[model samples]
Target: MDCQGQTIEVTEGQSCRDVLSQAASGKTLKKSVACTCGNRLVDLSAPVPRDCSRLEPVLADSEQGLEVLRHSAAHIMAEAVKTLFPRAKVTIGPAIDNGFYYDFDFERSFTPHDLEAIEKQMAESIAADKPFQRKIMSRDEARKFFSQQNETYKLELLDELDEDEVSLYTHNGFTDLCRGPHVPSTGFIQAFKLTSVAGAYWRGDENRPMLQRIYGTAFADRKALKSYLAHLEEAKKRDHRRLGPQLDLFSFSDEVGPGMPIFHPNGALVRTILEDFETKEHLRRGYQLVRGPQLLRRDLWEKSGHYQNYGHNMYFSEIDEQVYGLKPMNCVAHMLIYKSALRSYRDLPIRYFELGTVHRHEKSGVLHGLLRVRQFTQDDAHIICRPEQLQDEITGIITFVQDVMNIFGFAFELELSTRPEKSIGSDQDWDRATTALHQALDSMGLPYAINAGDGAFYGPKIDVKLKDALDRTWQCATIQCDFTLPHRFDLSYIGSDGEKHRPVMVHRTILGAIERFMGVLIEHYAGALPTWLSPVQAILVTVTEAQNDFARQCASELHQAGIRVQTDLRNEKLGFKVREAQLAKIPYILVIGDREVQDRGVNVRFRNKEQAGTKSLSEAIEMINEDCQEPFKRGGMRYSFSN
Candidate 1:
């Protein structure tokens, strides 16, 4: 067998661990919890088949290997929970992206004290060095065993499976039903932590019994675990919900309803800046702006396939006893606009953009502050083009995404999501859509991964996930290739042959939801936004009321220069005013003291508390102007002040 590119002779009855321990070069058998044998993942103790031609050890540092470790950690956690509370019953535990969570049918919710005790017990189990032994049993035998153990959740899961054989793993006098590939022993879980606990429903069905969920994470070593914990700490401090209100940008009221953000003056100004910049950028790229009604007839939505596929997430009203659905998407209105015109292939690609606000009946449980809201605005657009123009349209949208994300100083990744099982389209249509997206991505040489069966109901799409300062990714942009909507709406264009040919639609969004984007921005910049994006770019402070007139004059001059300036002419001390501006995250704090008034200049301090020295009034205006325009250059766009 070839193990890690080296030839190793394996006896017929020897296990993978047995052979690898004697021949593997870099990895120890203790760290190799599993191995991939001819494309199948198996435990290290599995007997190497005679026909096996290739094998690769799964190491602790690799993603797959970490998943194995976390999976075993979940089992250890479950064992610890059972030991602490004998009445608790075990359910499913799986490794997620950052950690693992196991849901349990406990009589009461697990508290922080319970988590602490569970962690203590888990530490004991890991230190005991108990070997994790795997066993196989017949379905009937497993059922009888779990039934006698009173593990009802496992029995329910077992009853749902059709396989005759079942796998089980055990350690520290505890066993659970699971597929094999655990670490050789409990001591392998060296760097682990129990993060938090929450309530989750079994199988995500709200009608079912609720269960307590224990969340935890494990790493290959202590250093990695420490770094990850630091990142988590920083993320908590930079959470958008906390920063939004603290920065005086936005707020949410229980009386105003959830998921609807009440943007203060500052938040509104920032949002306007983003929208205005996007408008100019879109118009420069040959996009026409458009708008549609907030609610449309239910029959129109039905014809668009949204009524069937997305009805659960939509809100409906009755006017004159006719049902009208609140628009969850802007594509339907854009489709009607396309069908209203009849043209030759010359108008092949017509791009229409809208900063459209939409409403979705999001579940209360999933309603996060701004990230997952019921009402939000989208930088939405729809492009209608002939079949021949499909690839170019897709490429153009991808470029649009790249340029915009670049302007915001964000690094992004892409994924091509294919047609889902619940989607609306024929196999031929889905294939053609996927091919167009694939060809465009390949032509541009843009690296992207495929997410199978995660597309919109009407089409396949390119999902752009942008990384924030914390290295966490947010879903901000998406480019979709849609053929269903045009066909359903009977949208067509005249071809050179004088026959009506169906046009394809491309649905897209740059900054997916304005609320979510702003939330991300607040956290990305740690509430210290750029001068161009800051509502109050600078605040003028006076010394002992002597320079109040001078401060007012300076503020007015800056305001006339189109720099957002505010005046703090209060009887407060200069230090107090500066500290308030700094806490509010103003970009520039201008100090107008007696000496600064006589010199006809002001001292500037940046939000970072760095002193920028004194400059004349005109020079200060010019400096702030440059600061505002410099960010636009990141997207290669040149800006000039108003004439």
Candidate 2:
């Protein structure tokens, strides 16, 4: 067998660990949790396959290698849990992006104290360095063994297995059903921590029993773990749920309902500015503004396939013996508008834009502040073009996304989503749609990952995830290529040959939702919005009653200059007023006093602690105008929303 680019003679039954121990490589066997034999991952202690021809070490620091360690950590954690609370039944535990989690069925929720005890138990197991032994058992035998322990979840899992044999991993007297290549032993779990606990539904089915989920993370070394913990602390400080109300942006009341937000005047102003900017940008890109009703006839939804595929998440009401579904999307009405007119090849590609509000019956368990809300507005648009024009239209949308995200200084990743098991249209149409989206991304030199079976019910799509200040990703933009909707709606256009040809539809959004983008924007900047985007851009503070008149006049001049400025003439010290403005994150705090009254100038202080020397009113306005235009330096049209 070839090991680490060197050929070595191997015994027929030699284990992977035996080969690793003798391989001449810089990566020590101690730093590896698993090894790859050809294309398959295998545990170090597992015997090599009879036909294996090549082998390589999987380092503990790589992304996939980290996942292996995290999964091992999860198994060790489950062992500790079972040891402490024998009555606690364990279910599936797998490693996620950030860490790992294991669900337990118990009578009560796990507390912080319980987590500490569990950690101590896990430490003991880790110190013992027990070997992780694997075995393959027949389906019947596995079911009977789990039945004896009263592990009903395992039994149910076994029942769904189509394979005649299942693999089990056992360590330190505890066992779990898994298809895994775990670390050589418990000793490999070097640096780990159980972070927090929450209630989760079994199998994510709300009707099923609720279980306690313990979340944890692991790293190759203690230093890495410490750094990650510190990052988590910083994330907690920037959480939007805490910063929103404190900044007087938005709030939610349990009495009103869950998943519904009440925007304060400040938040409303911010939203208006954002939406207005979107409107101007869309218009500049050749998109016509449009509107759609909140409720559409049920038959219309059925015709568009939304009622059939997404009925479970939609809310329906009866009006005078007719059923109407609250719009979960805006494409249906946009398509109706297209069908209302006769089209020619000259009018092949028509883009309709709308800031449409939609409603969906999201589960209570998954409802987050603004990120995952039931009622929100989407910056939605639909493009109808001939088949030959599909690629250019998709490319145009990609450019539009790039322009908008660049304005906000956000970097993004792209993904291509394919058809799902329960999707509309024929296989041929789905393939054509997927190919159109893939080719468009390829032509633009944009790289994207494939997200199989995660597309819309009617078509395939390209999803864009934005990276924020914390290096975390959020789903913000999408461009879906849809061939089924137009065919279903019988949308057609006159060709040069005087024949009726079908038009294709593309549904997309620049910012997925206003509320969600705002949430991400708030957390991205930590509530210190840019000068142009801030609801209150500046505040004028008066030193004494003598300068009140001057301050008011200055405020009027600034306001007349199209600045969002206000005056603070309350009976308070100038320092106190400035401090309050800073706390509010106002971009500029202009101070006026007797000297400013005589010289006709104002002192400028920025929220970032930068003090600009006294400047005349005209100069300050120019400074603010320049700040507003900075976002457009990325090659977008100049339109200041602050006005």
In terms of lDDT, model 1 sits at: 0.89
The TM-score obtained by model 2 is 0.95
lDDT of 1 by residue, 169-261 (tens): 989989999986888789989999999887777887767888888999999999999999999889888888998898888999999998889
Cα lDDT, all candidates: 0.89, 0.92
Q: Provide the clashing-pair count of each candidate structure.
A: 0, 0
TM-score of 1: 0.94
Give stretches of model 1 more than 4 Å off. 4-13, 49-51, 638-643
Over 531-606, each residue of candidate 2 has an lDDT whose tens digit, in order, gives 8899998899998998899998998899888899989999898889898898888999999888888989899899
Error of 1 at 561 (Å): 1.3
lDDT of 1 at 171: 93
Model 2 poorest 10 in a row by lDDT? 634-643
Residue 332 CA displacement from its true place in model 1, Å = 1.1
